[model samples]
Target: MTELMLKYFRKKQQEVQTEKIYDTQCPFCSMQCKMQLIEQSIVSRKQYKTVGIDNPTTHGRVCVKGLNAYQHAFHKERLKYPMLKVNGEFVRITWEQALEQIKDQFTRIQDEDGLNALAVYGSASITNEEAYLLGKFARVALKTKYIDYNGRLCMSAAASAASQTFGMDRGLTNSLAEIPYTRCIILAGTNIAECQPTIMPYFEKAKENGAFIIAIDPRETSTTKLADLHLKVKPGTDAALANGLLKVIIEENYMDEQFIQERANGFDEVAEYVRSIKLAEIEEITGVSINQIRKAAITFGKEETGMIFTARGVEQQTDGAAAVRNFLNILVATGKLGKLHCGFGAITGQGNGQGAREHGQKADQLPGYRLIENEAHRTQIANVWGIHPEDLPGKGVSAYEMMEKIDEREITGMFLMCSNPVVSNPNAHFVKNALKKLKFLVAVDLFISETAKLADLILPTSSYLEDAGTMTNVEGRVTLREASCPCPGEVKHDWQIIVEIARVMGKEKYFSFSSAEEIFNELRLASRGGIADYYGITYERLRKEGGILWPCPELDHKGTTRLFETSFAHPDGKAVMVVVPNKSVVPKEEVCSEYPLYLTTGRVMSHYLTGVQTRRSPALAARNIESYMEIHPTTARKYQIVDHSLVKIESRRGSIIVRSKYTEEIRPDTIFVPFHWADSQNVNNLVGEELDPVCRMPGFKLSAVKVKPVNDVNI
Candidate 1:
């Protein structure tokens, strides 16, 4: 039997040479750092090692996580087959059994509870082709109105703001290669040094070339240390700081009147609001003083070429979208957009965040970033699907809103793919409970993720290295991710799995996709004339070029690597300056007598979101084994908490225990913790569910809490 198994393995791998390499990109972050996956054989075992590939995004540099991506793809606990919870134990089940069960459960739920009762939640990590199929699966196969992805938790705020402000949303307005020549950069609530270290070299080059750098964050993160100016704004106060900066820009005559007159609109209203903002109030809201704000504003306003990059730190708040818009105001007011090295972009964190949102997977959007609510956009997609416009469901709720619906028993069944909301969502305890309420859940994942543990049936799926599809990077570069290996066991590509399920549900014709390429071709047609035009982005072209940026509307077009060079995507051919009212930003759960400290959550070096893949990575796991709260030394003294001491941090919503790591880099009034761990260590457990009015993003970045030493708690 052993010899037969060895022969089977040998036959499967085709007796390949150990040194064989497949060029691919890292499967983790939006940077999509190019790397070569090398096949390694030890005795009867085969694994992979990655070497950096010279590319526009990474410039031949890969982060520690990128280097270890292959390890997690073949992690020890990788799901090998479909599993069903029988008698409270996950038992191995054949694919037929799993599909039959899902079909029966889903059909019954839809019949009894209506189509809206079944929800489809997906991930940003999956390829763009996979996202588009899942969206189709939900709409055509199930005809459900509830469909959303994990990106709503992370990127929706920035997407909302950018769309409303610029009339189109691209992760970066200017490609990353242009940053080194930029004269100034504002790192707004993004820790690129830790979260996206590979791309930091561009900023470093710009710094060497005399570019002024400004970092705005509550904690003095690695990103802040490198900045020429650190605006340590109080937690949840990003909007106030941004509004005040715009105020200073307008008041000091730093805004370009000529540019505003020629290329933008609605600045007069924004100017009206900016003038009403008082400097004293701004200082009181953001911790930075008036003098610092003026200096930073002046440096940015006076710069010939500059860019502003924002992240979750500013986008995961109760006012996340409004805050992001306020930040965009500075760039627009200065007439800095659409020019080389002058624009605004949200720093996407997920591997395919840029493409995933352009996608049909989003609740309110169709492929090509077309809005579902619009009759024309709906008709366009409906025609591509060969379905009547009436057959397509209307817009659904946001990600967290879907959780609420599940809790209310409105959404009784869900097809969860690739996302681990139990660890990544706000009020995670609530999410877990709400997920538990689902009568049926079919999860497709490479690993038994935190969310998968609760699934009624879990399907093993191909890992990133074992799948071939295209993903859009943070710079809006849509690049291909080639398969390095075949699925080791019964595992299948995610698109294949979803198609199989669709066939079982009696919708095979609509989803009869033979390959990712075929699906991508349909996506191109679906997105042809929409804002995020992909008509010309063919697989043939992707392989030949480094990467092609979107709005490649024609076969002869080389793609718009530099966005807004000619005009914004709006119908009027001009950007809009959204008038963000100057108001004091308030935390959803305010810091008060009981919870006397501000608690913020973020990523740490060596770890990725939810730690599903990164934690399974032996090296990355060892680098940051146990979660710890970063407490200011002064705050630590007040709480009698010593370094490495376990502390109980309680909020109005939930409580978590983590060892404290004293640091002076954080504000004394605020404590920081990384949200890469699960269970009690999951900081999302303490985060509130207050939705941003514009973006509907939960307040994941800011909360109120109090900490006590575990010993004191025991007493």
Candidate 2:
């Protein structure tokens, strides 16, 4: 980490070279939306711009966010060198000083409180290789049992549902190419219009092909416009609604008895549970008419081939995993799986959400999505890491639990990697307070994010355009992100940064990765024989095919586009249809006299999660300058609030003031807020600290709040 070592370690690109174009992807969402980066170089400077490319997943339709993805790298606030917290203010420092100090502080913390005292909070936005390296660095060099990622907030509930229902976790059960031919499509909880605008064409094509589309949400979004039937299901009643669908499907005799008998387990329990769910009760709980519910069930249940999609809005509930499982129960009962045009998928939100979670970044997982506590899985990963099986740490607590540990002083230090939890985590103020309690915090980011500003030391990392690694898109397509240009200044790829720190700490024996590809080579070996199975996915293959889906276990094996083509991943070659009783489903918060409105949070088309990167784009920044609460016109009238007027919204946890926009786009008793700003404008400031018991995913979507009118404002 010394400047001398860094001088030797870093290679500068020579005098101006011929301009070139490289195939890459946008850094915003899981569409990873394929794009071309045109790089213009002058000496040590690089200016890059993005152009959308045709692909099966997005079909060349990149959003405004994707088109301006490269702007953040050129932002004035981008970190050019490591910065040390000197006398409560960040000051430029050599990499040597920062890393040496971090080593000393971390070692001292571990000596005082044990190895688990230093935890790692990773990101779903980092590449697969970097995610693998992060897991290895923690378990091998740092020897800590605490490591988790941002995906716990985005996809953990859906992931848990997939693994429980299908015996494996892949973002999509089938490819995006097959969507057009489906007989029906059910979109539950996902807002495709804003979050995944690029994939809209696929569903539109399905509509053209005479397919029926059903949308379920608490709000009427752009996606609802495309649905033949829109079920405005009440927030937190996802399980009840799903149970109602199953009940109607059974009563209508639409269940595929032959398929269930041959391909699944626990169906009898599922059937028994649904038998007790009455449509009237479901109507009361979900706030959807019984007739509409019956019609939707009949439409989808009678279809021979169709798909069901779920996202964070529905999966971030207290019974999130169970709610997802309930949807899967409908899928299994319908038998619209294991083939083309018949599938289930959880739309991913982060750039590397699917890939990062598969490669050992989660607290209870190893590479290949293997369980950490399983002896055989532990031994396999231990052998690949060149460490004893006993040396591997046991399952650690989740991301939110780590915060509690920090508050208790059990974890005094943390390495925050590429995520801005201060603004993204539920109960933002509480997370920030816990972060303040940490004895040492090192944040890796390209700019001064909300969390980075609070770090004891901040390290500069290369942007997605400056790094070459593999990413798995929403359809489970693993594509390579070719570096469009080299890292500028003293910035380094995250993998390189970790490797240098490991070498400096004298753990080079296990952390000496020369490049991203080298780390990927080891990743393939580590992933062998496990459920996610990335052993056969090579960089060359990724380029040749544009992308390849996983479970490709042999060099000559073709990748699996449809995960459950024949048999399930469970030991018995059958999926377990988890029976979730509707009576057990209850939200952590409820609408009371004080907090009478149901508050839901989501994304706007112009901004992405945490908004650290997209907010830098002049085009996007101009489109959306700040966050606003979307209140129904009727609801706004009740509080004496007018259109485009500033208002204060308060929850049990906290409160924030924001401009209010009155529209009829949402439910009368509900409020919608976009969580992309900081300070008083941050919507997450009012979010609760409730987490799902199974996946440990925070209930970020649904909360209870009260609104009061403030100063008048208009857009």
Candidate 3:
């Protein structure tokens, strides 16, 4: 495998010398750093070399993952054809045989077990057009209500909080260009320096202009290193810290009373709740000092224009929705929103996280970010598809819940696309077992991932470079991804595969998209009047303008860059401030004598999610060969463990052996592990499946665990 990868990289390097580089965006993270892919046709084999492109987001900058992303297309493990599992062994099969088998099995499952028995698990990495088609195929073809995507695990809580507060969910309310102009910026739970490196420069510019940057996290991350103040709060205590800051802001008379009285609702109720949180209690609940909270409150409140940003760290908690709401409440009370250089939002992680949610890959959504249960939304979308409104199914369970139901036969068959839940899901060991209970599983991906390994049939799909589609970035910018090379071997584009299956299932009228452009054209009409309206964004416009922000309602209208400037999306045009009482950070499975440490999982700069694509790149693998636990020096000393010593981190759920790196960056009572590796090194094995009630986002950040020397354990 290594030799094959090396040979491919060598050939790519040699071919790049004589090939044309096509402009495109990175497939790694939501920063969507624009880059150019040089298509090289060496002899008869095709390869690519990635180069940075000058764009508004990156300005010709690319990270390690972006620079090496081209290698994923030519990896040794690239699936070249369709295969079916026969007697525990996969055998190469024709596309017709695979499609027929899927049609027969899916038909039988629905006929016998009903439509609810079949499920579709989509992806956040696919194009908006592809995601829209998958949702349509699930409802109109297979007729399943159990449809969701991996984004549920990452951005659902943020989405829920945004919608509940502002009546619409788009990760950011302002453009990335405004970051440097804000007087203050508070980042909760996100490590932009490592996770989204291109964004760091904007924060740096803010600091250069005397802006106070506060980083609220338990660990001292690359982002924290740039902070004016680091509020090292305890894990899962984000709500308390936010409420505490609000308390100080209110007591000190720093709030914008005029703005609050004019543009916000429920301020009195939320302010009363904030007034109830005592500073002493806040210091105890969150691990930060009362003085630190006061400093953060004063810096944030004094600023005329500021922004509050969050990511998975706060959004992956059991109280994630509450945390996000409380965070937004601070902004609303301070009158920091609806103005230039001021806003509150999340830094989306996946490549197309914003677009995927808008286009209906989520369980509870339809095209144009409409609710699946809404009769009007159903009627509107059904009319566009030339189907009856009654034919549309109701809202389904979320991704994690869908997985749990698989063991109960509620969801007997699943079509998994562009995701590897076995390595990415919380409580991964349990997820793997639940996957085994499926009657039939169809995996559509470029490689045979750990999740794909359990599939009844696997279909090889083209990589991002071989597909033409649109992807919305973190700032809600709609960008184009152009096809620069032909797919390898018999591999097909994901949209083509979905259309073929839909045709085979006798839904040809609805799935007659000959090209991505045709599907995108339909998407424009479906999203015409919705919050994420894309009617004004065409492929030609995207090409000419580099990118365009959403809510562009007409061809002549320029896209909206700053949302909620004069009015919000709510009917009353007022931001809603929800008041949620403080909750404990400890999980239901509390820390005890046997398992006394708080375990948190996060990402590293070198590798992307689950290590599916990045792991294939030799450059990335060489930077971080395997996963290791980051233990505080005090914790390491107490446990009698040295740096680089192998240790067994065990939880009630499962255990894994990893090398320990002692550092002062993490709290003494907490351990941090990167959840990129599979098998024993997979940290999700130690994570609990406690989900946020409102959004169904799992608490991937906090778990109870115990660590000891590997030699001391009887393995």
**Candidate 3 residue runs with Cα over 4 Å from true position:** 1-17, 39-48, 584-589
- Model 3, range 438-518, lDDT digits (tens) per residue? 999999998889999999999999887788899998999999988776788899999999999999999998899899999
TM-score attained by model 2: 0.95
Q: Kindly report which residue stretches of model 1 are placed more than 4 angstroms away from their true locations once superposed.
A: 1-17, 42-47, 584-587
What is the lDDT, from 0 to 100, of the residue 292 in candidate 3?
94
> Tens digits of per-residue lDDT for model 1 on 602-701?
9987999999889999989999998999999988998899999999998988898999998889899999999999998889999888888877888888
Q: What's the CA error at residue 535 for candidate 3, in Å?
A: 1.0
Candidate 2: clashing pairs of residues: none
RMSD of 3: 4.3
Worst 10 residues of 1 by lDDT: 581-590
Point out the higher-scoring one by TM-score: 2 or 3. Answer: 3
Screening candidate 3 with a backbone cut-off below 3 angstroms (N, C-alpha, C), the clashing residue pairs are none
Model 1 TM-score is 0.96
